[model samples]
Target: MQDFSQARNQVLQQIQHACDLAHRTDVAKLLAVSKTHDADTVRAMYDVGQRSFGENYLQEACHKIDELKDLEIQWHFIGHVQRNKTKLIAAHFSWVHGVDRLIIAQRLSEQRGHELPPLNICIQVNIDAQDSKDGCAPEDVIAMVEKIQQLPHIQLRGLMVIPAPNHTQAFFDAQALFKKVALAYPTLQSWDTLSMGMSGDLLPAIQAGSTLVRIGTALFGARDYSQDR
Candidate 1:
């Protein structure tokens, strides 16, 4: 197993460099993307005092949440969440980063049953306009955010996006999209978290105004996709 302390330090260095170059807000939060990784790895990160983790699968997140119930970990749902899985995610995860539709938002709000705190949510935007991606189109993002605002069970925190891979134009694409949403949703006081960037291209995302970068391989080593599936 890799040393969490060393990994944490390395991740911090990357975050610091990004902040230094981009003049990013000092409050940018790092979410250790722990999807496909096992409980031991999560525990290893927790052992090193890391508390925030992001997951891509509902079932996998449920399993990890149950196993790590005793730890003070904040779970983030970062995948294409289905309506059927809303209940499970609503009950456990503190944040949902892939909420792109009003239906999913309403279901998540209703399923919470007044038992848990309002779910922190970010509207996912298809900044790259990739047909394969699951997010609201850039042109329609404002309307979506407005619809989600009516739901009281969920707190609209900010915007999230998954830009095209390995594209040199990612920075401009993400910045433009984020700026559009920020302008449209100016009334929403908490619309500040831009959950963009990933292990491969976080620096550009930061330069484009991302306050939260979902990093996996950089902190946990390359994922074995075969085992993940």
Candidate 2:
């Protein structure tokens, strides 16, 4: 296993240094992207005080959630939200970071068990309009937000983006969108999280006002896709 304690501390230090450079008093929270890693690896990360873990695959994530039931971990579904998978995602994860459509949000709201707390979600935006990306157009966000806020079981948090590598301007654009939404919906107290950045480009994202950074390879090492196959 990787030295999670040292890795986590190094990441934390980098976050702090980035925040200092940006003059941001509030440091960004790290969401360990533990998609392909096993449950034991996640448990090791949890032991090092990482409370939030982001997963891309629903089946793999659900298995880990079941195995790590005893840990007070906040699960985040960071992959493309499929219609058929929302039920399980709603029932298992605490946050959904790739909600692009109102229909997806609606299904998640309807499927989420009432006994659990409201599911926190971030609207995924294709800030750069990449053809390969799975997010809504930047222009469609306001209308989508207006409709999604009415859902009772899900709380509209903020924007999540996966801009092309070195496309630093996209990070600033996402920040602007996040601020615009927050200003427009002044009544929403939960409109706080901005899920952007990854292991490679976290510094610019944090400086651009990303509240939560999703890190994978740096902390957990390279993922083996053979098991996923």
Candidate 3:
């Protein structure tokens, strides 16, 4: 096993390199994808000074949130979110990165009572237009953005896309799509965050203008699925 200090530094260096290459100094935010990692690892990361962590599973995330409530960590829901869990998700997660449907948005907006702060949301886009991907297509982003803007309880931040793997050219295409959406929607003032890329293709995504990169194995090493079994 690698030392957590070394691992954290390596990832932070990579983030700095990506940001420098993109000519975007301040926008690059590293969200440590902590799904499947245990509480010990999460605390280790926290000990090393990582404030933002990403998780895919709702229940799993909730458990971790409860366990590590003492740490000042910002949790981001990075996986396919179910409509049934809107209330819990809204109540816990500070940001939701996979919102693709208006119904889900409406549910979250309604469940987010006025007592709580507005939920920070990013409309996920399947830039590659994969049929199975859980994001809105690039062409439909404008309509979705318009609808999301009307919800006073949800703050529309920007767009997120999971491009098709192996198509390295998809990064450029995704950036073009983001530019188009930004041009179409004037209310989206914070068209600043582009939550794209992962371990294998983050460089190109950064070159294509990505602000946040969700990295898992690269930082924490391969996941041990045996725990779930």
Candidate 4:
């Protein structure tokens, strides 16, 4: 088995360094993106103190969740929210990081189990407005946020963004939008997270006030997608 302790610690140190450089006291938390990795790899990562994991593939993630049920891990569904999968996603994951549509949010709210605590979610924003991305346009976010906040079973946390590569300005744009929405809805007590950044752009995202960074490669090494074929 690959030793993950060093990689995890290195990433943590980089986060702290970025925070220091940005003069940010509230350091961004890391969300290890565990998509395509097996259950045992996740368990090993858990053993090294990674409590939060994000997955993109629903079936694959559910299998890992079942296999690792004994561990107290906070599973996050970080991919595009599909309507048919909301019920299972609502029941199984602790956080949904890519909610962009009101209908999707409504379904998640309605399907969440009463026994479970309010589902935590982040609205995905296409800061750069890339046609290929799966997020709401920046201008439409406030309206979506207004409707989503009224959902009874889901807590609207904040925005999740995947800006264009090397576009530091997009990170700042996302941060501005995040603050704008937060101010628009001050009553949302859980509106604190700004889930942005990944392995390549962690520093700029942190500097722009990201509260959560989804890291995969730096923590888990390069993923082999060939197995999926």
Q: Give candidates' CA RMSD values in order.
A: 1.7, 0.8, 1.7, 0.9
Score every model by TM-score: 0.93, 0.98, 0.93, 0.98
Error of 1 at 147 (Å): 1.2
Better of 3 and 4 by lDDT: 4
Model 4's TM-score against the true structure: 0.98
What is the TM-score (0 to 1) of candidate 1? Answer: 0.93
Q: Write one digit per residue (lDDT tens) for candidate 1, span 18-137.
A: 888977558457999998899989999989878899998777779999999999999999999898889898899999999888899999888875867889998887877788999887
Query: What tens digits encode model 4's per-residue C-alpha lDDT throughout 9-97?
Result: 99999999999999998889999999999999999999999999999899999999999999999999999998999989998999999
lDDT of each: 0.84, 0.94, 0.84, 0.94
Position 218, candidate 3: lDDT: 85
At residue 177, give the lDDT of candidate 1.
Answer: 66
Give the better candidate number (2 or 3) by TM-score: 2
True-vs-predicted CA distance for residue 115, candidate 3, Å? 2.8
The Cα RMSD in angstroms, rounded to one decimal, for candidate 1 relative to the true structure is 1.7
> Backbone clashes per model, in order?
0, 0, 0, 0
